[model samples]
Target: MSDKPKTPLLDKVSYPADLKGLSREELKQVADELRTEVIDAVSVTGGHLGAGLGVIELTVALHAVFDTPEDRLIWDVGHQAYPHKVLTGRRDRIRTLRQKNGLSGFTRRVESEYDPFGAAHSSTSISAGLGMAVGAQLSGKKRNVVAVIGDGAITAGMAYEAMNNAGAMDARLIVVLNDNDMSIAAPTGAMRAHLAKLVSGPTYRGLRHTAKQIAKALPPIFHEPARRAEEFTRGFFTGGTLFEELGFYYVGPIDGHNLDHLIPVLENVRDAEEGPILVHAITKKGKGYGPAEAAADKYHGVNKFNVITGAQAKAPSNAPSYTSVFAQSLITEAREDERIVAVTAAMPSGTGLDKFAEHFPTRTFDVGIAEQHAVTFAAGLACEGLKPFVAIYSTFLQRAYDQVVHDVALQGLPVRFAIDRAGHVGADGPTHAGNYDSAYLGAIPGMVLMAAGDEAELKHMVATAAAYDQGPIAFRYPRGDGLGVEMPERGLVLPIGKGRILREGSTVAILSYGTRLGEVLAAAERLAAFGLNPTIADARFMKPLDEVLIRRLAAEHEVLLTVEEGSIGGFSSHVATYLAANGLLDSGHLRFRPMMIGDRYAEQGSVDGMYGEDHLDRNGIVATVLRALGNEAEAMRILNAGRD
Candidate 1:
């Protein structure tokens, strides 16, 4: 802690070119300054804190060593790219991280030239980076391509597939294995232990050097014997005999924190004459900072917090988050039903299965980063007469869409999907937004798709899923706090395909589902002020829709408007399809306007800010309803007598 209040060299640096003139000694000082700057920026904005903190040194080192914009660098998840953003001409916009029409939380190709490949999903970097590397090789371009992947991200099958192909192709690529010992939660599966042995354990380097020297000395007649010596030595030391088998020359288990070692090791890997390589750089999760180190997972992706105590600065919650509600409800249902089990892929706390695991340890399964396996595993469980509740984030569940369709839906297995984060998830931006689940799930035959309007309804949906043994069922809920409604102490299963009418009116009907119901109600109130009494109905089930209610409403109301937080193919489209098929499309000019998440990806921002920008909020919904009525301009506009 300097008493003079040292200004960060990193703050002054706007691009990789600015860091060019500085000596290697000065670069380390810049790294320290960048760490402080990252901490400060994330504290105010409340973005992905722990990951950015973990990669401060690595970001600095890579930029220092590699020609960034020219030499393409792809970050796996982009949660760790905050510091990279800061270094690459976006420092001033750092405060606007995740804000709609502002800077994105994840790396975007449009956001900066340095970011050649952008991602919010995990295990994609290796493939993307390898593709770029091969392209560069074919184009005869002189540039290094590096993919920095966390140990946790490496568990996904795609990363290994990329490694295997990159190795076989012998593409000029550098893979920096940033082993941080955690994902959103502690990593599961054998890959973790294997990485621990190869990256964290010593004895990785001496064998590499010895093998190279032995290969050089061997004559043409002794070529086969020399190859055997290298293989034996690799088996003796690196134990990762796996990377070698894949065709990558593995070097490391190096200290990522020490710049002395990191810079030189990176330089060597960059200079390495031929073939693909893996530099295993071991690092702490929340490095340098004491409070962050203590509770890495909590700080991993956080809201604004006090820097001194690491306490999340806030007001007391009016209601528990939807995640907590889902977890608690599942626990209660699982208690009575011995056949019920829970599953999550990589996320325990985020999906709220941490509590379920505590209570029903044996029944709860964390299947690592493999979402495809988790869904198929649930189908397997369902096959054996066990009820499997596969709790996954909506965005991640997209990875297992085929399994949900082929295995669960096709077989009509009773697998309950508790789809969390099913709407505009703030700060993480477009890549992470849970905008596709509703549409994708609804399209699968034999799948019962439901959405919760509020937390109270979420309880009912959970209970409903547990009781329903008909086929594959799913219920989606948004991220963050629930509406301040009194929660039911006892879980009661609601009737499937049934919706509740919250408010009644005549001229128009506003149909809503999931978190956006609050906006619809607000729009209804606005409509009433203008002498337009709109009927507001909470259409809870997306699939097996309340056809009876829909037909009656279309007959009664002048306009039937449907709104949901998902994409074009979601709830609204389902309503349109239903109307067209049932001869309701000819039911006069009923003016059916379906509102949903639009063509573009929703960016991270204040929940209200994103909703406003995307026209998913109260004012936007009201405007749409008003426009439909042809009474938006003048509230008192009267209809012509006997027009029809």
Candidate 2:
């Protein structure tokens, strides 16, 4: 870690209550100090940087203006909550961000009382906050609920739904739309700030309330025009007509960096008796840091780096990443088939669609944070006979399962799902783990599922998905570099529902799925030293069950094992179900075991370490095979040594 920066004001403040006694100027000093602290801590920890930097002032203003823990503060996506974390008595462990057994990169409910709601995915804050607000009112408790959502997150339909509900219910809730990148209201100047302050201020509200009472005594026809005139006048200046239409009292395009503007408006929002109020604060992502500000994503997510030079420390890679391979192979396929198109849910670069966009700008669609829409949009495209590859992370894909089943699978549309980050993503923790795609997608009838055993296999699956148009198909690949295997000149479309044996053996058979094939091969070699050589086979498609190969393995070997980097009801479940129904398990001579991710969320750490923890690593596979062979002592020895 680098030398700590001098933070005099920050040293005096340990919690939000400490800020309550300070002058506005002194609070500004705290915000400045807090910004420095976030930058320094992120340089060592390497998590979300720009978001924390962007909301430094707003974080201070909100905490200072409100009574948290009782008021209920929720940060949408939790990316902008680093400064909140620091001020909430987690400063000692701030440097341990995203580490295993340490602070989470996103808000975790168990981590702190100040964090009322945990969040990692986007656009859920408002709904949660409204629920809290309504609950508090029902309980006869005088408490405030505040949900801070980002501009990018606001694009999601969930946010709008929550706003509409809150408006109809007349819940006393506050939604702060933090406009950092998308500039929901682009104009953020003195005029906007003045109008925002005016709308939220006590004087303006009191006068408006009086006018409503006087208008109430007038004719019924005049009421609508009076209300429209008041709203239009305010919306004209604030540019928050949409929010107003949703039943919220829209406040501002206030400069988020200015404490003078933020404090007063937030104070007004706190004091107001209104049902629901929306505060629009415009902020610059990576505000105080020059290097981050200059970055394309403002260092939204980063690796550990030198604090002085802003040079991020990255590990050198000898092999190409799975995402890059997918991107290139898709580009290659698209070049041949002009009907091919790509879609991403606000993750162009993360899904490698940015590279595809460069070549085929017209073919790529970025459906901002709306995975549900992305799925159905691809379904619509496929209806026109256009090949649409919806590339989404395994975790984020959960958001669109309804659409996948109803819109794509039910309709038998040929929408190809490019499932990235297939299993056990490190550092981002369980929230980002790609462990359920196989299980969820496998359940739907006519849904063909394939997991890449290696980068080369990934290419084949991509080609296979593109070629097949009978029904909805999905191909999953892991989060990092592939097995460093030889790449095929061009991907070949494999026959549907078949698996290939990598090695042949007599005693036991190991049926592998996804990138775990590399580990399976290693375990097979290890078993060779034990004088119990095991056969290894890669099950390319999980849904089809590979009955022929599975039956062969069950028939040839005394023991059979299924291995995949997924949890229950995935590859192993399908194999077990097939084998059991065929009377394989009742043989009494052939023993079977399925190795999968444990029935719990894995903490953030090295992917290899997490795999080892779950007994899914090379050593884990070896141990499982040993125990299956009835070499109990040897299996225990290997397991103990691996853990130690």
Q: Which candidate number has the best TM-score?
A: 2
In model 2, the number of clashes is 0
Q: Among these predicted structures, which one has the highest lDDT?
A: 2
Model 2: per-residue lDDT, tens digit, 517-635? 99989888888888887888999999787899999999999888899999898999998889889898895888899999989989998899999988888888888888877889999
TM-score of 2: 0.99
Backbone collisions counted per model:
1, 0
Per-prediction TM-score, please? 0.90, 0.99
lDDT of 1 by residue, 1-644 (tens): 24323556665788988887888888888888887777777777787888778887888889988988898889988888988998899887887887767888888889888889888889999999999988988998878899999837888989999998899886779888888883322323334334334432234445556666777787877867777677666555544467777888776565677676677667766766566888776678778777888888788887787676787876589899999999999999988999999999989989999899999999999998999999999999999999999999999999999999898888989999999988887767788889999878887888898999999889989999999999999999998889888899866888788888999899899899888998888888877787888899999898889998898889998888898898889899999999998888784668998988887876666666666665677777777777787756542231111111
TM-score of 1: 0.90
Considering only N, C-alpha and C atoms within 3 Å, which residue pairs clash in candidate 2? none
**Residue 264 Cα positional deviation in candidate 1, in Å, after optimal superposition:** 1.7
Question: What's the distance in Å from true for residue 379, model 1?
Answer: 1.4
